[model samples]
Target: MRVAACLMTLCIPAVSLLAAGCPDTGASYDDFAARYDKINPGTTVASGPSQCETPLGSDMEATGNWLFTLSVKLNPKKAFVLSAAVTAEMQDDGSMLVDMSLQPLSATDQTTPVCGATIEFTDLPVAPDGSFAWVLAPNETPLSLCGEANPISMSEILTGLQIAGTICGPADAPFACGTVTGIVEAPLPDFDLTGSSFTMQKALTDGSFPPPVLNCERAPADF
Candidate 1:
């Protein structure tokens, strides 16, 4: 399982602003555009390259057992929680080396299981204050979409996935990524997180680390 990790101590009072301009998931192209226009009001996706904003906003204590709750716009009822263990060490180079271990806290929504498989950080550069920012922009290779049930075997599902639309972010910084648009298949687009965010809080009551849960139903044996 491949997991993307983020290390930051952010407190976002303006979380609603984070959802603005992100691509719409689980909606048709026309609907996506309409909603995008409604939120942005006269802006265009093709306007230019937008920076991929980090969900990390303000600040909090860095090292702790955190309950990471990822909220997606598509399914508000679904749960996306991960147990995160963060360790920060001061490096000789005057930067902090941060590492995080993240695992599913329970049965998650279809998207969270695969996307939240692992969170790794090795010698990541950080500020003097131990805060960092990062965004997992879409890579050149499209990712395999997973679910609770596979139409066939997980391997088949992975190999057969078609390329879908791009997920965009903020604008005008090395922290962001360039934008691209494309047509996607039906049943809403895959890997869409338009107006979604990962919010984390210290698990004050749960001192024990979160245990790993079972893999998605019909998942590949190795997975």
Candidate 2:
């Protein structure tokens, strides 16, 4: 399988400012916009740059296991509620194919299979702090839209917010060339933490036409 790896980490507080129904100060977006300008730093907006091209396939591979450490503050004193590690197998078809056997650690101390839309190459980007930013969009399914399932995951609620973007790179590049990362935040819900980091180091492999066969026997049978 064609493999390319990217690393990400994000630290966020467990409280929800929006859930409490507070107005946004555009803090997150403003920070992102600042970084975007710093990287692109040009007057004309750098149109038609090779990095903006779509990936050849939908699968995204990883050179090593992707890890995330979440520290939650349960009370005003800032206590540790939980931490987790999620592993994904990059498929040739460009999906962040989940191992299924892997589960998320919980603040509630429950083990649940992490499922849903697969992570894509477009999802990773480098934040200001050099950590990998994992962006998630609100699921638009009938159940989700109807409030049957919460738009954001409970884990995400405890963590920081996610933002989505397009992956761009050379059209003829061997691997799907793009970036991915995450931003860290203070424990306070409404406050924006400065100096968050994101980093990415992709391991590119040769692309094959028919795609290589994946060893998915270890994945959950029901998935």
Candidate 3:
């Protein structure tokens, strides 16, 4: 009888735990699978409240209108120029978050460029120096908003993509502002753009798209 009573006590706690439900950690098997998908290097899962918080900057003062351009030195005509409305905000975790909306000013193929069709990336980090780099490799952090390209072979494309420049300027207002240059490394014989340059600038506007909003929302942890 004593043994059965002890077994019953243990089972009671297990049942209570099951009733309590899973912890609100904002982590799940689906989130893990989506984030670590083998096919897409830049696929991003929408963050839950526990995963990230709303950035600590204003919409108007913290946003800027910018332009981003990319090209391959091997084929100069195969290029794209996009006008981006950018916003940079400091998170409560002391990391900066950058969000951008890019529209193609000129594109070899509008459907298959750096950022695919819509260019909004949630929860991307930025450095204090206003510099960022997005590498196209699997399982890498600090991902760019780049989407899938239309299967341009390494031999045919003949060069690696490159981008470099000041994204968020060193000021407290009107976020992104700086001179940026784009270059495709020449003599890249082995399917690489070893020393290419990329950059961004303020875009000229005649009242086109609406201003971008800071998309991250923060929620306190239940634990």
Candidate 4:
């Protein structure tokens, strides 16, 4: 599993959300991953170039790319912009699904060390209005997405606004990657949120900074 470990102390107000029950109670997280495999089929990402092929935002306006100015405050002094090329499809069950392969982009204009690292979020549901949340796998099976011991769990509180609609927060959800230090128990709501009516300009969450430069061409071919 490729992991992007974010070390930050985030304290989001936890709030309860209504449940979106699973179709089967016996199903496991593995079951969900299998469903995702059916959707994405098979894929392998080739290592990306040391430098991105182009400045990140140049092609954002082009069709098929989803350019979003995000609200992510890493701290009172620093924040990060969120941008990615999104692919969505209708699942057999009628739920709309999405995939976004993550790359490290620089908001500071100065190149950041995270250029070629990869973090992929696969098969999340997409709402009609574009708001979406990862409701987590069923409680019956406790295994990390990477097949390790389950590191964290999502609560109804997290399923509320914190997990909703592309806001970069997941109150109680740790990443699919195994244990991320300092965040093993309660990973920094550390998600790169997505989905908002295709807006390119939005309020700067922490300060003025460009979104990280992404290499969408390097995104996994199957995704």
Candidate 5:
């Protein structure tokens, strides 16, 4: 009886964690992005001339946003040791454009070209709650590394390599997809560096999975 009770006790917590689902999941991709403004990396609730701002383009508004830290993995095995921050603003045309900044939960010196700056996701439609659904589109310009045609995408900056995946909407959004959840056939090359293609340290695939847990306990207290 004692042994059986111990086994059952151990199993309960494991089952609880599994049943809990993701804690910081976005209602939509747009919802999670507010996390960035919460962290106040750049934009703030400043008033008058100096209000909510961004490093992307021009200042779109004065109302600041929130920053939610979520976990992500790369390739099939490698998880993002650091958490990434997402922030966004709506363009005049009603389309939403986002700015992703990678904050390697480790790495004290802060490296160059954080993973967030790699892809330029635009034309996403923001819902009433400010959450967005995004889809990747093909670019005429092929992305290359070392003069080799990587064939992924052309950056909005019209520069070097970028990666794109084929999700029409948020696969892990809090809401349900009523219909039209079909996958695209024969998709283009992705940024899966873990596979044959060269990696640029971005999300391996576009599907939203649960955020990863911290690999180390010694990580910064702020993290």
Candidate 6:
């Protein structure tokens, strides 16, 4: 009986630990979606100013009117990393166009081109509550500004953005998986443009899932 009791004591703690690691999935999507909507209101896009030629390196100076935002969530006190790439276009009608995509760099052990740094998971995680923000910079690279045909600088500048969320326990844990949420804002410059525009989308997909287009714009300046 004493031996049986000892075994039970060990099993009890193990079971409790297992329970603590499991996360709840009911509020997962809704929580993340709400945060996304808050940051990226559909009507933030608008028209602004025109582009002036820079004197130094013949660079075009342009600004944006709207802000972009993105949020994510993870569980089990594990690491979650993100990388994104954006593409812009000048519409024939004179509006600005943009495209954006995000990829998980360290969460699932995937490799990508934009994985600049790995976000380490901490006991005091920021997911589900805090977010990281960065601004969408001007197309510093030749490829960003001129597309595939023109290759200018090696570095690109992104502007006005934040990524925030929580890293909770595992899926099966009682503490529940933490959520990561935030926004990425990219404003546009103005011009006497008609149809010139751009689209912004996220590059990362869940695991091996197919890539998805998060946002798009044909006439950002018209918004």
Instruction: Please provide TM-scores, in order, for all candidate models, with all chains considered together.
Output: 0.40, 0.26, 0.39, 0.33, 0.24, 0.20
Expressed as tens digits, the lDDT of each residue in 1-223 for candidate 2 is 1111221112111332112221232344344445544543551111201233344232232322222222221321111111112234443433443221112323232222233322222223232211222332111100011111111224233233332222222323322112212232322234332222211112223421211111111111110
The lDDT values for all models are 0.33, 0.25, 0.32, 0.26, 0.23, 0.21
Backbone clashes, each candidate: 6, 25, 1, 5, 12, 92
- lDDT by residue for model 1 (46-162), tens: 231122233222222345565554433444334345566766565565445556665544333322344334534334334443223322222222222233322222221121111
Question: Clashing residue pairs in candidate 1, if any?
Answer: 10-58, 11-58, 50-170, 51-170, 51-171, 52-176
Query: C-alpha displacement of 101 in model 5, angstroms?
Result: 1.9
Tell me the tens digit of each residue's lDDT in model 5 across 12-127: 11112111222221222222234323433443211101211221122232112211121112222222233233444656754344544323332222222232322222223333
Cα RMSDs of all predictions? Answer: 14.9, 14.2, 18.5, 17.0, 20.6, 22.6
- Of 3 and 4, which scores higher on TM-score? 3
Task: Give me the candidate number with maximum lDDT.
Answer: 1
Q: Put down candidate 4 lDDT per residue, 143-185, tens digits, no spaces.
A: 1211111112221112111122222112221011000001111
Name the regions of candidate 1 deviating beyond 4 angstroms.
1-61, 91-95, 108-117, 124-131, 141-191, 205-223
lDDT of 3 at 183: 19
Q: What's the lDDT for residue 127 in model 3?
A: 45
Q: How much is 56 displaced in model 6, in angstroms?
A: 50
Between candidates 3 and 5, the lDDT winner: 3
Look at candidate 6 and tell me the lDDT of residue 11. Answer: 15
